[model samples]
Target: MKAKLRQLFRAVPDTWKTSATIRSLLFIVLGLLIYLPIMSDVLPKTFDLNVNTVSGVTLTAPVTVEDTEATEQARAKAVRDMRPVYARNDAVTVHQLKLVNFVFKKVTDLQGQTETTPDAKLKDLKESSPFALPGDTMPALLAMPAASLTAAAQETNKVVTAVMQKGIDQNVAREEIQQQVNQQLVLADLDSRTRKIVREIAIASIVPNVTIDEEATNALKETVRRSVKPTMIYKGEVLVEKGQYISEQVYHRLDAAGLLERNASYLPFFGLAMCAGFFVLFLAFYLSQAHRDVYWDNSKILLLSSIICLTIIVMKITSMGKGINFFLPGYAVPIALGSMLIAILLDTQLAVICSVLFAFISGIVFNYESLLPVDFRYVLYGFVTGVAGAYSLGKATKRTRILQAGFLVAIINVLTIVALYLLLSSSTGWRDVLNQSVFGILSGMLAAILAIGFLPLFEGIFGILSPMRLIELSNPNQPLMRRLLMETPGTYHHSMMVANLSEAACEAVGADGLLARVGAYYHDVGKMKRPHFFVENQINRDNPHDTLAPGLSKRIIIAHVEDGVKMLKEYNIPKQIIDFAQQHHGTTLLKFFYHKASQLSETPVSEEEYRYPGPKAQTRETAIVGICDSAEAAVRSLASPTPERIEQLVRRIIADRLEDGQFNECDLTMQELERVTKSICETLQGFFHNRIEYPDDKQVAVKQA
Candidate 1:
């Protein structure tokens, strides 16, 4: 049954990971897609740029015209003729006068048309089409203005195609089409005054100087000419005829009316920058992945992500404070990336490199203009804040500390702003200083708050285990440790002693003393499952060993190491601590059992079976524990522990363990072993500080020893 269960659990990992990988890939693609459109540029920078313009750009008339009054007359004629017609009456009436031979024929016998309804009217269209009028068919069509008629006529493809395909030469056909269109427009009836008022409206428009590639320009020109000129009026009189004067208002009016066409590819270029920038950021994240650590894992990936987010935020910020031309003396890039440097990367040295990169990026983004020198103060600000942030919060950082560091950064940012302003601006006023100072202070706090807020997200995203999280987990109130203490007090006490010795030895050897201590605290947690089997908690009681035979005793006790490993697994304790529990008692002889077994039966029973099954101590901390656990028990067993005897006993036990090959797996040097021996002797001396007595001084010791 147990073997079957193990086989079942083993299959879960592959299935789980394969599904997770596929899901993660999908989300990554989705996120990348959504993020691209918001990048620097892709769509038109100004929506107005794509609008069809309503006026020309040439306000500069031909030099051949030389009269101010002629310009005025020309302007008056333009305003009168070009004004759009409006209907103030109760009903909208259509005008149809002098219908052309082509227009009439196209509606009937010219082409394939059995029914009047065009474009195959649907149910919805059938109700909405003007041809489905309330009255009888062919009510007298009211005459309409030429411009409106021409615009509507643009949809008359049959008429236009007929004119083009006629046997007439191209030039002659075009001229005839124009003249025929004008005659039809003139005959279209309206109030006499309305017709007279709109007599000189010209059909000219303004196109901007677009700097597109040849193909795009040609296509644009074709589209504009067809969409605009084909829908214009050419009747009665020409407004702003050949010699009209154009004013700034007219130019602006035309520009607003969809006549503007400036074809610059600045938009796509900006989008390209945005994509490149994000790609660079992701690349930085990839390179920084090598530095990720556990309990020490924050890396350049976190810093890079932070910078990317901050760069976007600062760009938005600068946009809000528009017209900062050089006003931003420094950029926000360095501060953001640098702030995350210490917690993630673990190397303060690499932080400055990040800062320089951020500085350059900030200068590009936050710098006020394309021309003139960038005030460089933003770069300086970014570099300083980043370096300072990284250095300040590099190790053992808590959330509050990260935030406090940001506040300190804020102060520095303010100072930097003030200094830069004083150095570069003219007549720096108190108001200006105050504003800059406030902005700097706010920015700094934001940096700190943002960093603190994002740390957990990064931790989860990158599988980073931070020291702060480890410390919190190590706290005694944590569920696992608390259970150990409450359910297995003796094991807990023994673990504590081991922790102290190991921590001290680890510190003495320049190792991670905290990790050693934490590991030690939980190393023997498995003993809790069978606490009474150990002698540490056998206080005020007879020796259980007296009742049990040596072989059974050795087996029961030797089994604790394996038992501990089982317990560690059940609790899902980390591998490092489990290693200590398994190896602290190396495969050494349990001599007391072998001696007893020999006395009972001299048939040469193997001593190897009585020993522990171990791979031995593999680190200084585990080795220290093995020595200390024995030293403490041995010293406690002595009936009379004089200082010299205790020292001798400590040395002998250490020697026995050493020769038994107990410390072989660990990297403890001879010098370190001697130090460990001295340290134990010294610590024991403190614990057993009751005064020594001479032969005659047993009675006197109570009074004066």
Candidate 2:
């Protein structure tokens, strides 16, 4: 049972290839699990409170929340309570004055009629005027002297004009306008009967000149409403005590804060599901667009999913400590750990993307006591710290550099916390600020430590070739490298030269230089099994192939590639290094042995028998390493090696490999190949360049010193 469990754990990731649909569904489900805990508050819960019942349990605000419904209701009431705005219609006042003047002009024109009798003139004045007057009032106006009648008309016009100029709007009542008119006539010189007639004229002419301005009134009310901030229920604030009755206000507050399960709405959960779906789709789109190679590889996908799931689980566990949450911030969780590990194992660009995704996940999972489920403070803290770790480790080629990256992450974490505190927080108490800053710094350091601890496990389980792993393998003190040096010194030197050439060329062509150099170091490990059989290690000038048949020699030569693969697997070496061991020869023929065999055989010799068994180079780095291996070997054999001769040899070897289709599987562009040739030539030329020589006696004296 133990063995079966171990085997199942080892092979499960590989077995996912059985169904693509299942694999995609599994990824989606993993996303849901990672996000579900953060969204649990949104799901429905049961509230066991009756309308007038005593509270069974004390309820407090889980998070700071705004009473949006109540706030909006208050704003609406404020708008309704506001006085309506009004605008003056000067045109209506002007027309009213014109009608009053028209009545006075008709009275004057009727009085000027010489043939008309006093009674007829009075009746004519009434008929001509658009305004109506009392019969007794018109008769009195005609009976009075002309000067007195003119004075009364002038007084009436003055009173009416003054009322119109006061600017009456809809807000001004008709009685107010009439009161002002009556007051003005009380002090007039006109008789009581004449004053009564003028008062009636003035009242009729004064229309309500004030009109309601709906747009202006609404705009003013909206401005006031927006100015009023919503009243918030703060986190940790008391809602209901142990024995307190559950009032309507308390029930509503609980419902708004998402504490009442009976009032719980699934709308928020649906929104959460949609958000999770969006994250999944966005990740897929980003991977397909930016990293097609990783997108297509199921193993990389599995590895990525595992890291995200593990990180989120850790965050959830840390956030679950409600007691600790009072002292330690949710933002203090070590969210940068995943990014640091990923940056070391994968590309920095992918690590940067992982930083953003992890930050978003952190905000959701650590949202306790926050106003919103997505806490921007935690998001900022996570993103800055994660990216800092990745950027710090981007160019680091040693294991100890991980420690330096951790310090960098910690410093950045503290700065981010400080900045967010100043920006997002309303209170700036020194104690809270200093405490948060300390937690942030500790969080960053913890991330670095966690990353360091988890790195080896991830590398081993996933078979990942991290930079640190490559560096470890490249050390000469390793068992394999040391054994090669002790048993086959010449081959070791040759491998070192090949490493230098391949590394330079890979860098020139924008490939993984470290991987190429490390791969070159291990490429010829197969030759160590038969050290004396190969020419380089045969230091005594004795040729082992001379007595043996050409077929036998060829068989011995071909056995090394397979032997190396077995040896590497036995030592549990990563597949990346094993690829170099397997593909360095790349099906090239052993021409010296094959030609010798052709001369001795009676039947025609087949080219297949002399060639090394190969699957060919599967990547640009592997292909370049193979080309460099051949170039270095061929150049070493030149009796009079010069810059021109070395260049020709390197170019010829690459051309032959190209013609033989050894690089066909790999995507090596023509431009990149030319750059590789140039880089290798330059390195070889310098290595073989002229060096000053001294006498043997002088050399012995220097060696003694």
Clash count of each predicted structure: 31, 5
Poorest 10 consecutive residues of model 2 by lDDT?
Answer: 1-10
Return the TM-score for each candidate structure: 0.51, 0.73
For candidate 1, the per-residue lDDT at 536 reads 74
Candidate 1 residue-wise lDDT, 285-341, digit = tens: 544464433112222233344444554555455544433533433333325534453
Report the Cα lDDT for residue 408, model 1. Answer: 77
Error of 1 at 461 (Å): 7.5
Give me the candidate number with maximum TM-score.
2
lDDT of 1 at 392: 66
Error of 1 at 366 (Å): 4.0
What is the C-alpha lDDT profile of model 2 across 484-595, one tens digit per residue?
8999898899999999999999999899999999999888888888888887898876989999999999999889889888887677778789999898888888899999
Give the clashing pairs for model 2.
Answer: 45-261, 47-262, 168-210, 169-210, 170-210
Clashes counted in candidate 2 amount to 5
